[model samples]
Target: MNDKQVMVKMVFDRWYALLKNCDTLLNSLTDEQLLREIAPGKNRGIYLLGHLIAVHDDMLPILGLGDKQHAELFEMFLKSPDSKSTEGIPSVGELRSHWSKQNVMLKEKFDGLTADDWFGKHNSVSAEDFIKEPHRNKLNIILTRTTHLAYHHGQLMLIKQ
Candidate 1:
């Protein structure tokens, strides 16, 4: 395989591992535990799952994959006096199913892109500012995004205390 393909494969493997870890961690939480806030101002397991899904949903489009827009998913996690309760937090089973679907969609989207397509420049806004940057390649974007998710996952693990 070419270097680009090899790189994509590596990113894909890491993404798969992240998903597996999330599934395992989530599976260990009881419904009551998932809904219980570990501490004041801290997100519950359900909220974390929603946030994770939101991150992937928001970023996938930037990688050139047109999928469902779930921006509101993240908004629900934000602290607001008017914010709704975690009652809407899907069950671990439901989150797993959704995660699996998204995983498949991600793999298909990544697999369909050509090496040139992966490296093509697209106008992408940075998270901190509106400045545009060329998203080097889907593999690069995926790697960065995976790191972000993994970081959050680590935070989620700390909630077990």
Candidate 2:
């Protein structure tokens, strides 16, 4: 592989590591633990999990995969207030199922992208603009989302504090 391809592979490996760490953190929690808040007024573990799933669901179409498996998630997890304000967020089990399904599918789709595709424009960038700045690519999207996941991982830890 060339230098760019090697770098891209490193990024992908790092993303997968972050993802695995998140899965490990979540799996280590009990159902009741998943409902605990980071702080008295902060979001719950389940709420954060749902929010992560919702954002990653969005990455589907943006990455040229397919539509969101749970479009309804936007309202509950993305747009709505935290678990403190939301009235009827899905149960922990349901959200866990969605998280598992959506992530598995996303990984499958992401794995299908060629090395060149990683350096190509994601849906967010127009073709003309991408041509002018090829650095704004799908790999950048993964980098952004990895940071997002790690941020939430920290919050997840606070539930136990």
Top lDDT: which candidate number?
Answer: 2
Error of 1 at 64 (Å): 1.8
Model 2 scores worst on lDDT over the 10 consecutive residues at: 80-89
Clash pairs (backbone) in predicted model 1:
none
lDDT (tens digit, per residue) of candidate 2 on 76-150: 889987846435778888988888887778888988988888988899999999999988899999999999998
Let me know the TM-score candidate 1 reaches against the reference structure: 0.75
* Model 2 steric clash pairs: none
Residue 118's lDDT within candidate 1 is: 69
Worst 10 residues of 1 by lDDT: 77-86
Encode model 1's per-residue lDDT on 1-161: one tens digit a residue.
89876766777788889888977877776766666665677766676677677778766677767855565565664443213374655565676577668767767877788876766553364543332444554556677778988987786676666
Superposition-based RMSD of candidate 2 using all C-alpha atoms, in angstroms: 1.4
Candidate 2 lDDT at 79 equals 92
Off by over 4 Å in 2: none
lDDT of each: 0.67, 0.86
TM-score of 2: 0.93
